[model samples]
Target: MKHFAYISLCLALCLLFAGCTRTRISSFRVETPEAPEVEGVHAYMEPHSATYRFSGSVTISPKETMAVSGSYVNYSSDSLMQQSRSFSANGYYEFGGSDVNASFDWFGKASVMLIGFGVGYDDGIYHHLKVGFNTSVVEAGVYLGLYHQYTTLEINGSTCDTWPCSERDNWGSMSETNTDFYTNLFYGLYASIIIDDFFMSYNLSIYNPSVSGGGESVSSPDIYSHYIKGGYRISKHWEVNAGLIMSFVDPDYRHFAANVGAAFYL
Candidate 1:
């Protein structure tokens, strides 16, 4: 749609004038470690069409990261288009980490989808809390919480999506698994701003994980991640979004990704 194009153009202009280095970093060697998931801002700006919502997304960081995630939500009331207080319960799952991560959330809001807040827990990994204010054209918020970190290693075999690949002569299967050696607790901060359908967010985490169990003690660097996203509501029941995610692992490593997603209301 025309609105989507305008949003996309705005994002492009922002990136172009950001004044960061233009060096082309190879995506294959970048590692995200315990990167956080992308948060949705459009969900806070408007009412849903129905009491149930389902959403899914795919993200690719060239050769570095590939992931899929899904979520479901159930509202307590039948009609949610009016300005009233309500409650909802939701579940989310993702297959991008060393192992799968899942969580359940309970949300309470006092607005016609214009201003809201929620608190939830993340399956022993994260404690979630967020609050936001929204108007017809702008939305802003902050999310901060605690999370547990794990020491993990991932290995992958040679693989290609198409047959008879020109990139390599040999075709092999790919498998990824991780072993957790220790765990540490860290604090995370997330801040976001949205204008119309375009949004931007930043995440920060800084902590040192002391060695526990059998792994040798090592110092870890701080993590910084951010993204710019744009979405369009095609109908009351459907919305589509696309964005870029960039995560820096401090010191010398970073991960860059592009994602596309859709949400359905029913």
Candidate 2:
């Protein structure tokens, strides 16, 4: 009940925040003899063009606000046991970035998390565009990103227990696996800065609620996600990056990751 209330509140906030988002603002580019191109946080070259990069990251300490499996009390055996877990697998991502113009830059990232056994799997993508300005010490930008995550969950039995389990009554006499799939979309605002070989960026995203099963849609500001990162160039072709990424199942449920990765440029 508490979780449901929290989710309701968050959805309300998301709608409110989304209404405040401004349309993309256009600006004149700074003309130079040289055009700059970049891929992610690593490689930067002149005559800005399409940039390609490969990267790998590890998600550390992902908090599970909602359990992927189920559990219950078996009166037949007078025992308490857990069903199975489906969210223990590691998450991975593929990242890409490019300079759309002298004053505009765009970035894209795709991620996947799989737990096998047909238990759980998630695929997500994030895309952002920024208008930028530069100084001797830093390059700054105002950014907006759109993110979508598709998740599927499968659980076997234990339908009686509340939470961590699907809502159902089965008296432990009959049991079957249950599967559920859902999708979400989010919008974000961020500020990015680059200082020579080092860079730092952060974003705040709000959920964009939707209607399902003929239900009314919702609005929320409390429901949101966060991304923060820092990276440094090690060589002309290699770069190292680290960051924390956070997501929520609802206003009350969440997931978090501490990530470290490297980018190789073409």
Candidate 3:
């Protein structure tokens, strides 16, 4: 099938560019390996259901991570489905982390469809603040943020995914943990372009974390993360995407993942 071939080509390209660096088909992360992160644009350029919208997506990185994210948007009072100006709140809760990882973002866009522009804040591990501009076909942005890495102690327990926990609960556990935190700074740039029903995006980020002990602080080696993705819209309310994600922290600490995802608009 054409879709199968497309995915195969993507994987081959990822392997080719990964080079001789130690590569694992796993989630990419800056700090905790257990907390694999997948980042990308979660919305489409046009064909929104209304001025006020809700959207959700699910992404899976083969042998790596799976995540679910959602967004809510409020368009400018005078606008309709095609957002000329809007504000949005987004968030995700993911599995495949040490335990689990959850984060949120707030974003605003202006002058969309023509020369679009936006600013946002992310409470994720990297790139907490972002600003970007877009045209009808192209988009670009940069982001910077601070993260705290921590060593955690967990004992005698499990994790929960819902409120009002019950005995017959899935992924339920009794656990307690404490963390010792260190500081990290991250900055990144991303670009995306859309043509017809096809779109592609790329993100690159650098992370630097520091540890303090014995009255002295030492900085760790910088880590670089990359996410490249391409997708096609199948219908007005549905789309499918596939991409490659990678991170480098020297030759011995390289990580890669290939992901596929779908988004729905409402």
Candidate closest to the true structure, highest TM-score: 3
Candidate closer to the true structure by TM-score (higher is better), 1 or 3: 3
Expressed as tens digits, the lDDT of each residue in 66-104 for candidate 3 is: 221222222112212233222221111122222223433
Candidate 1 displacement at residue 52 in angstroms: 6.8
User: Candidate order by lDDT, highest to lowest?
Assistant: 3, 1, 2
lDDT of 1 by residue, 1-266 (tens): 66456545644664677621111111111123434442434544344321334555666644443331212221111222212222121111112322233333333344643222222222225554555554455555555555554444333234332311333434454433454533334444444555544455555543333221111111334445565567776776676877776666544556666767776655
lDDT per residue, candidate 2, 36-103, as tens digits? 11223322333333334555555455223332211122112111233322212111111112111211
Count clashing residue pairs in model 1: 0
Candidate 3: which stretches are off by over 4 Å?
A: 1-31, 34-107, 112-127, 150-183, 234-239, 251-253, 264-266
lDDT of each: 0.42, 0.37, 0.45
TM-score of candidate 3 relative to the true fold: 0.48
Worst 10 residues of 2 by lDDT: 26-35
The TM-scores, one per candidate, come to 0.47, 0.43, 0.48
Best candidate per lDDT, number? 3
